[model samples]
Target chain A: MPGFAANKVENILDEGIEKGGAKLDNKQIEDVIKSVLDTETGERLKIYVDTCVHCGLCSDACHHFLSMGRDPKYSPAGKVKRTLGEIFRKKGKVSPEFIKSASIIASTECNVCRRCSMYCPFGIDVAYMMKVVRRICHKLGVTALYIQDTAHSHSVTMNQMWVKEDEWVDTLQWQEEEAQAEFPKLRIPLEKEGAEIMYSVIAPEPKFQAQLIYQAAIIMNTAGIDWTMPATPGWDNSDMAMYTGDFEIMGRLKRSHFDTAARLKVKKIVMGECGHAFRSVYDVGNRWLGWKRPPVPIIHALEFYYDLLKAGKIKIREKYKKSVTLHDPCNVIRGGGLADKSRYVVNALCDNFIEMHPNREHNYCCNAGGGVINCGPPFKNKRMVSNKVKADQLIATGAEVLLSPCHNCYSGLEDIIGHYKINMEIKFISDIIYEVMEKPA
Target chain B: MHDLYNFVRGPLAWTAFFIFIAGSLYRIIKMFVMIKKKESFVFTFWSWKYSLRSIMHWLIPFGTVNMRMHPFMTIVTFIFHICLIIVPFFLFSHNVLWDESWNISCWSIPDPVADIMTIIVVLCIIFFLVRRLKEPEVRFLSTASDYFLLAIVALPFLTGFIAYHQWSSYQFWLILHILTGEIMLMAIPFTRLSHMLFAPFTRGYAGSEFGGVCHSRDW
Candidate 1:
């Protein structure tokens, strides 16, 4: 017991948890936790709680635990023991301090990546438990400020980044014109009824990464694909509400997203290279809406790229001449099963492709994926520190460039590369595809 | 001593077996009914194919990443579970009990093989106890109930091994074995040992979600 200390990461006082906790009483917290457990949960949650034997096999599956010096608290089972286990043991008679740490452990510490589920002897979905904890936190007004703010933006604007309606349309037009200068006929079609595909992107694409939209336009036009982007609220496919555990707002956001595609009469919804958003539309949000599946069939961009390249819709001008390793985003690879597809797109785009040691569905999460990074500056150091395994994984691949197909992964890997001083450039698959694909002259 | 062993093996044994069967059924049915009430879609999405595949993979030793990561634990756990079930059902002695009680019995493992398995099980239980004590992650989550549950799982095998070897006080060990076995049977529904009862369904549901819904392998 002597000389034991956790590596210090400065904690920032988050107003979201602070303000929410300040307003809450123990009676309200107990009621919220009890109600969510009794009513919102089904056998999945109950059986998982009962079934885990405390074997701790899931510890290594977590990047947080592996990265954080093998700390017990960072382990998946450890986190659940602290949050859900304690709550159930006490029958929801927990204090605000308990709720505050529980919120952090559920929302920020764990990525809900489902990697642990794969490793568990029972295939217990710890992520589902974390989501339940997050839901209770949401109900009791104790969510992370940054992600909660994004969820607020989702409720109001149906976008995480809160890009205005005109701004959304303008970004598309601007990217369309930029691509037009090279292709001379490229158009980022907005709200074209009966289009074969509805191309949706997270609002951040328009807000911060508009060039990604421009690159997508070039690829779509080069491939002669019929795609439409809505000039409305549902244009952004990302739902921060899902991460915030505000399921009501998540349902509303998903409804608007699906309703938009149906109104446009698009055949399928093709989402951009964002992991959590893909999870929202393709898995979580649709389920919450009581649809067995997305009413409009959804294709993650990894699949879209694979389909395009396989069909010879897009021709590579020249393969990228750098050694590259692929970082499989947890949501798309593990959650969506696009590992092989993403690899296909990468192999087509690059001259030299390397595989990370535990590639495919077995890959580790980008700590940034499950809204952990979006918990913002308060947890940035903690986020980077919790990504030590990832930084090491990236360094071990010894590739000149790392192709992360998801937006969150791209940024997350970039931070890891910088933080750990790993010498690798990070990029999305689209970045390489657009670079090498032939543009119409 | 003989009468005590007879009582445990007769009435106490039957009572323990009855409780195990009835309580397992009650818990299973209750969970299914509760799931139907709350998340009925579990029924819609539940696939026999994925469930079987998922359960099968997990059943294999070192089949999952975490299993491979902890090969020692995996091998020990696989041995522990296999020996635990096999030594009871296929043991030459226990089958004799079935033969005496119901005039029906299954094929029995040779006495020597069953004895080796019993020793292996006792050793595995020791490994589990040490790991639970030494591993911080496990220790942090372990309650007094957890430790008690481990002892409950360990004792029957330990007592059985000593009785089978005809160690010092074998008559006493024999009765202890019967009592411990009954205690284990009775504890299955009421303790963390229920994992054995519910693992298949939990694994099945997760397998279905990943395979049927996400087109992914859970294991």
Candidate 2:
């Protein structure tokens, strides 16, 4: 636990303090200043730092602020003031005490959801600002353990979960077997060249939630979509390297995923229900690799569902009986722009749809994501408390079930809902559709 | 009097038009090229589809529908924009220039509609100004440029309205309008108001591709 000083998290914090904080010798400060602020880009960074208006409109949008009983200091603006503000004011001449506090604020306090940007009259992206703080912390080598560990896995195995190549194949085959039990003829086809779609997923699907893969396969089989799952290294698309700000590893993970798709020569890639993973392939990773856009197109699960419904490839034998509301995943919804289509899918699948007030791009974030929840048990309480706004929104929707499209949102919403003791079932959109859609003969 | 106004108007009109067109084009083209070279959100189509859902949203229906998804702001925004757009394009003096420039004859809205729109727009501006002051959230996020932007916009309208009413023995209301208009045109490229060009692009690309990645319907 971070509360214990000798823990790994604390060690990383101490290391950051030792390297960049005031405890550093004169030579260390010189090195730190040279490394961070001597570049030409430093001028532009300075302008951005000085431009903030100190308006705290970004507070309620932050799960950390809301969860912490509306503590003003936890707001995005306040976090910036305490960390980035101090650094800028001191010209990055921050002390060891400052670095320790900065580490705690960046690593544990913020989830980097861009919801605040929407509410910003100027559309200032506060999330980007927080990420810059995290980047500084990262350069100091002080990222949270679980997410950093995942990034290491991505660097070593080219997948976030350290999923071995053979094991990745076996898992698909295993899921295919399981799906066949539900729909006996169902197949999780692998490496079928010229397939229309190549299905990819995060490592967690195999590591913790193989049944999601099984459901997706069954849905595809029933829809008769020409999709194949890769048998090798690029099979997993989720990249924790992104959240850890390990741009180099993030780029490598993305390259392999894209290269695999290119090798298989699939027309397009369809990723599983993971928001951050979609953002990785679509935005950050590709940009880091110097591509303006992905070489091959990528489609998220929400788009896939909408396509299936529109094409009549999949038919709902009966509407889901439950009243359900949709939780927009920040990366896919706010970042990717899937707000309405998510609603369309929800409406198509469910009989009763109650709009979560402030739904769509304007919707609140599930604070568990952006690797905040991945900080593990030490920070679980903080994560739960930080997302009170989201919990309230979910409760107000008055729906018996919530259909969230992204994996992070699914897990995060589940944890928050449970923590708050809200009476609702958190489900993936596919989970409901898979149950109700008529399987092919 | 018309001749004197026309002389100043000819060069001023061209300057404003040139700045508006060239500056807006430069910003739009730059953003388009940038987005074209970047990655598409996995849910781009879905967002595009929804953003396009209400044609009315993109084209303000005016008094026909005052309340849209954004509520009070939407209505006020529509009024301000409509007045800001129409007054400059279809004002009586502007129409005279139109006749001289292209030999294209058109009519300004009759006094009633024009006055109503102008009043509505001015009222909205006042409401926004007051709202900014009254609402903590709005006040918190606002910058020096934000208040300056509102002033720049409202100054022309206020001066133009005063000149129309001839509220005082003023020599420079029309001149003030032209100067303010010029300032706004020049500022358009540099300010957050540059969103007039960039907003559509960012929204279109970010929202469109985002929809695709989320597996939602495009638009």
The DockQ score of candidate 2 comes to 0.09
State the lDDT of candidate 1 residue by residue for A1-441, as single tens digits: 433223334344789998998888999999998899888887778788888899888888999999888898889999999999999889999999889888988988998998898888888889989989999999999998999888888888888887888888888898888888788888888889999999999988999999999998888888999998999898888877888789999999999999999999999999999999999998888888888888999999999999999999999999999999998888888888887888788888898999998889988888998888889888888888887998888888899999888888888888888888998888888888888888777
How many backbone overlaps does candidate 1 show? 0
Per-residue alpha-carbon lDDT of candidate 2 for residues B70-133, written as tens digits (9 for 90 to 100)? 4667567766777878877777766886898798788787766776777777788788788778
Alpha-carbon shift of residue A138 in model 2 (angstroms):
1.0
**Candidate lDDT values, in order:** 0.88, 0.71
What value does the lDDT take at residue A77 in candidate 2?
A: 73
- Estimate how well candidate 1 is docked, as a DockQ score: 0.78
Runs off by more than 4 Å, candidate 1:
A1-11, B1-6, B165-171
User: What are the clash counts of all predictions, listed in order?
Assistant: 0, 42
Give the alpha carbon lDDT tens digit for every residue of B28-78 in model 1: 999989988888998989999999999988888877767788888888888
TM-score of each: 0.97, 0.69
